[model samples]
Target chain A: MNRYIKLVNFEISRFIKLYFVLIAITVISQVTGTIMISSQYVNSASEAIYQHGVSIEQFITERGLMSMFQVTASLWFLGPIALCIAALIFYTFFIWYRDWFAKNTFIYRLLMLPTARINIYLAKATSIFLLVLGLVALQLFLIPLLSTILKWIVPVDLRLDMSVTELIDSFFYLQIILPQSFVEFLIYYGIGFMVVFIVFTAILFERSFRLKGILLGGVYGILSIAIFTMPFFIFIDYLYPIELLAVETVLGLIVAAMSIWVSHYLLTKKVMV
Target chain B: MIEIKEITKKFGRKKVLNGVSFTAEKGEITCIIGVNGVGKTTILNAIMNLTPVNSGQILINGEKIHKGSYENVTFIPDAMTMLPQMTISQAMEFMQDFYNTWNQKRASEILGFFKLKESDRISELSKGNKAKVNLLLGLAMDVDFILMDEPFSGIDIFSREQIAEVFTSHLIEDRGVIITTHEIGDIEHLIDKVVLLDQGVVLKEFNSEEMRETEGKSVVDVMREVFKA
Candidate 1:
């Protein structure tokens, strides 16, 4: 377990340096956009309440309602997309440089370590999970900060008409509900993808004499995806009842289990030094 | 403490090891001398269970070695086969974390002996230094047997001499060192037994004193005469 942790720590330390740059960019863009948009909302709210003689409570409710949908809808798209791209890049870095890293003196040194191979695999998985989780958390924070800044910048009269608590409540609810579910879903998805990728590469490496492993892995991965998705595609037309969440969950679990088992078998038996 | 019996391996249709049989006693250096492509490395790998032999029984300390018995053996392949990406320290740390037999003090001493910097990545080192580090790690492991495939192939003459001395001084007293190499001149004095291989078979096996007295020549000279014959 300690060995696994060390491996995880090593991976995270290395990755954070690369990922922080992207985070910085995200922070700047989100903060700027929030400030700009909030100012507009404030002006619009003030004009509607004071100039048009609209009731303060109704104006506040209206603006809060609008902000709820707008903020959530934007985050619903941006958060997951940003996280997925970052996660892909992180995992891809490992795939791309595996051979170079695998054959290095460092790995030779590492191979001699008294740790189990499973620990190494788990370490990588944990690092990837943490990275994805961190990105999601950052995005979640951004949504609220954006909402607050927008409320502050809006005209004073408009601010009086709106219920800041109600506006924040909606944002928080969407932030928790969507991002939490999305992160969980992606965790499973990412692990499945990683298992398949690792196994394919390991098998290809064992079969070939050169660096053809990556190419063969890509080909194998595509074939596996096709095979795995065939059942879903075939049954797609009859999937209208929508309450078969239990069935869907069970099937997903089975597929993930099978993929993991296959990867474990290939990695243990087929991989060569 | 290691035994190989009737082992044969093939790459495609080309037979590499053909019914090769040998035993390596504890606390001795066994040199498997052969021409290139004669299954020297294959035999070592087979003993380590790194490669599957088509037909054979490899027993380490009376237990058969397979995928499960990997913990009992440590393999030091040719210098070229060493992982090139790890820094000396990172490699040591990894080894320390994995193997029960990892001796950090011994490894540290060896690292200090070679003056290997902690931050110097393996790929950044010269070929000889890389070999030195490889040998250092193999020697530090507290295993029953150490199988080295061409440990000195690409190393320099001076470094080879230093490595030979290190092998003799540190290795020969307590553990088995099985080495396969074409260059037997430098290691001639260090080896206690010689297993001469030709075309995938063990042609001869003789101890150092017996071979010297009977043949009136060193292992290198005997190799030349045997292969010539």
Candidate 2:
């Protein structure tokens, strides 16, 4: 347990700087987006009412408030979020490859560490999990903060004033990230966690077998995806919706366990630096 | 004692190591001397399980090597193993975190001996300083066997001299060491046994003193006869 925690902390420290940069980018871009849209709304409203003698209600009806939904829709707002997600996904693979490709062959040291090689694998997987969770939590926290900025600029009559949950339900991607119920959250993120592990295992396979392992890893990944969705195709006619979800969750867990086992085998027996 | 028996390793279609076997006893230094690409580093990596072998077994103290058993052995590769972003202190802490056999006091002593500051970042260090840090990480570990691959390769003469001093120092006293190097002049006298390798095969394994007294031939003399290079 101590060794595992040490590995986790070590992995976290390696990417902490970049993680902070990701957060900074998200916050800055999102804030700038909110301010820009809010200023535009206010400017257009003032121009029409003062210059052309239009009513405030008409301006309010025409241009919506700087709500979370509105903030999320703009390219300035969504662009950074998209970049953050893409970067994190890229990092999932880069974290493992960096050790081998970086100067000085850090993989040799990591592989030779006196712990079970599985600890290294688990630690890396856990770090990615923590990073994703941290970023999500930050996004959740920022919604309210960015909402406050919107409220300050836009009048209450013009503002929509929707809660964070309502804004999440408004968008498909947001709903996927911020599920309404605990079970939904688990089902969604559980499959995500499984994907991270599968990718990690695939990387290990490639590292172990080189070019041949690349094809093998791709096959293994496809198999993992197929296995997770098997319950849907195989039991949809026989099972209820609740039962189907339960079965899918169980399958996801199974795939995660299998990926971990295969990763351990590759790390211990086949992986070379 | 450490024993490697019939270890074979292949990278793609090329056989890097084939039917290699050797031993390094306690309180002795075993050196694998060969030309570049002769499987010298691969042999050490196999012993540490850094690179998986295709066949055969490695025994430490008469038991097959297993997970969590690497504490008894340490490998100082030619490349820097610690993350380049890490400070010397953090790297030490990292070693301490993973290896139960890491000796903090010995690590501190080695730091002082090498004149390496704990705050020094690995990325900013000179090549010689980086090599010293690598040696420090290995020697500080309280292990029975130390496997080093080309520790003296591509360094200034001063750095080579400093690393050579480590062999005679109490840091490695009473510990079995297996080292591989193409440049053998630096450690020729310090090594107890020399294992001559050529293209993944062990050409000769003999005690240094016995080879010199009985055969009246130094390691270089044998290398010339073995490879005719």
Candidate 3:
């Protein structure tokens, strides 16, 4: 357990420099975006009421109140979020590959760590998991700051004051990230965790077998996806909606368990440095 | 003892190791000598479980090798295992973090012996210094068996001599050492046993002293005769 945490910490340390850079990008891009969009909304509102001979009521009805939903919709806001997501996805594979491809091949040290090889696999996955959650937490914390930015740019009557929940509800992506209910959060992140494990196992397959392993890993990954979605296709006619969800959940768990077992086998018996 | 019981390893269809077997006992130096592509490094990797074998078993002290075996057995590959960006001190700290067998005092001692500063990044070191650091990391571990893959392969004469001097130094301290090298002229006097391999097979395994005493042959002379035959 202790070794696993240290391994995770070690992995985190390797990526921390880039991680902080990612955070900085997210902050700068999103805040700049919010201010820009909010300023545009307020300027248009002023122009319409003051110059175009429309009442504030007409301006409100025509342009709508400046809200975080509108502010969050801009490319400035979504682009950074997309970039963060893409970066995390790229890192999911790079985390494992970096050790093997490093100047001196740190895989040898990691594999020869005198602990169960599964600890290394788990620690890597855990590091990715922690980093992903860390970014998500950052986004959640950034929402209010975004709201504050919108407030600072637009006049009070021209903007809508939203609670954190209302802002999240207004944004479809935010709902997916920090789901409204605990169960929904579990279901969303649970499938995410399983897919990450499957992808990690696939990478190990490539590392172990090289060219032939790529085919093997691809087939393994496709099979996992097929199994997870099987209930929607095969049992849709017979199972209730709740029953189908339960089936999907069970299959997701099974896939996760299989990936871990295969990963453990590969790490211990088949992994190549 | 670190015993390899007839291990076979295949890279795709090509057999890199064809049922090769050997043993290295504690307090002795076993040298595996072969030309390049003869599976010398593969054999060492198998012993350390750096790569898996298609068949047979590896045992350290009469137990089947596993992750725990690393505490007692360590491998120093032909290249450094630490990241190039890491300083020597950070690499040592990394070892200390992962291995209970890490000896910081001995690590410091070997660093000083190599005349290397701890603050030097591995990437900045010359090939000879890098090889010394590679060997230093393994030797500093209080392991019973150390497997080195060609510690003298690309080193300068002075570096080779310094590394050869290590075989006779107290820093070795009775650990069983299995080193693979294509050239043995420089350290012929230091090896206790030699396992001569050709094309994935062990051509000969003998005590170096016995070869000199009984056959009146140096390690290289035996290699020439065996390969010629």
List, for all models, the DockQ compared with the true complex: 0.26, 0.81, 0.86
Regarding DockQ, does 1 or 3 come out ahead? 3
Two-chain DockQ for model 1: 0.26
Per DockQ, the best of the predicted structures is: 3
Please write out the lDDT profile of model 2 over residues B126-149, one tens digit for every residue.
999999999999999898889888
lDDT of 3 by residue, A165-248 (tens): 988888888888888888788899999999999999999999888899999999999999999998888889999888887888
For model 2, name the residue pairs that clash: none
- lDDT by residue for model 1 (A1-273), tens: 566787788767666756787687667766665565665666676688789988877877776633434544465335554655656565655632463345552333333345554455556666766776677677667656766766666545444332434544556544333334554555455545555444534443543333565676566666555555554667667666353344455555555555456545444443444
Model 1, span B1-229: residue lDDT tens: 8888899987778998999999998888899999777599888766654456789798988997543344556888774334455678877876676667778988888888777787888889888888887777777777778888887787788787777777767653588878898767767878889999988988888897788888688887778888889
DockQ of 2: 0.81
Error of 2 at B143 (Å): 0.8
Winner of 1 and 3 under lDDT: 3
List candidate 2 stretches off by more than 4 Å: A64-66
Instruction: Give fnat of each prediction, in order.
Output: 0.25, 0.89, 0.91
Worst-scoring 10-residue span by lDDT in model 3 chain A: A65-74
Where model 1 places Cα greater than 4 Å from the true spot, the runs are A32-116, A149-243, B12-15, B66-71, B79-87, B117-124, B198-201
| Candidate 2 lDDT by residue in tens digits, A1-273 | 588898899899889998899999999999999999888887887898899898987776776555668788888778888988899899999999999999878998888877788999999999999999998899889999999999999887677898888888899988887788999889888888999999999999999999999999999999999998887788889999988887887888899999999999998888988
User: Best lDDT goes to which candidate?
Assistant: 3
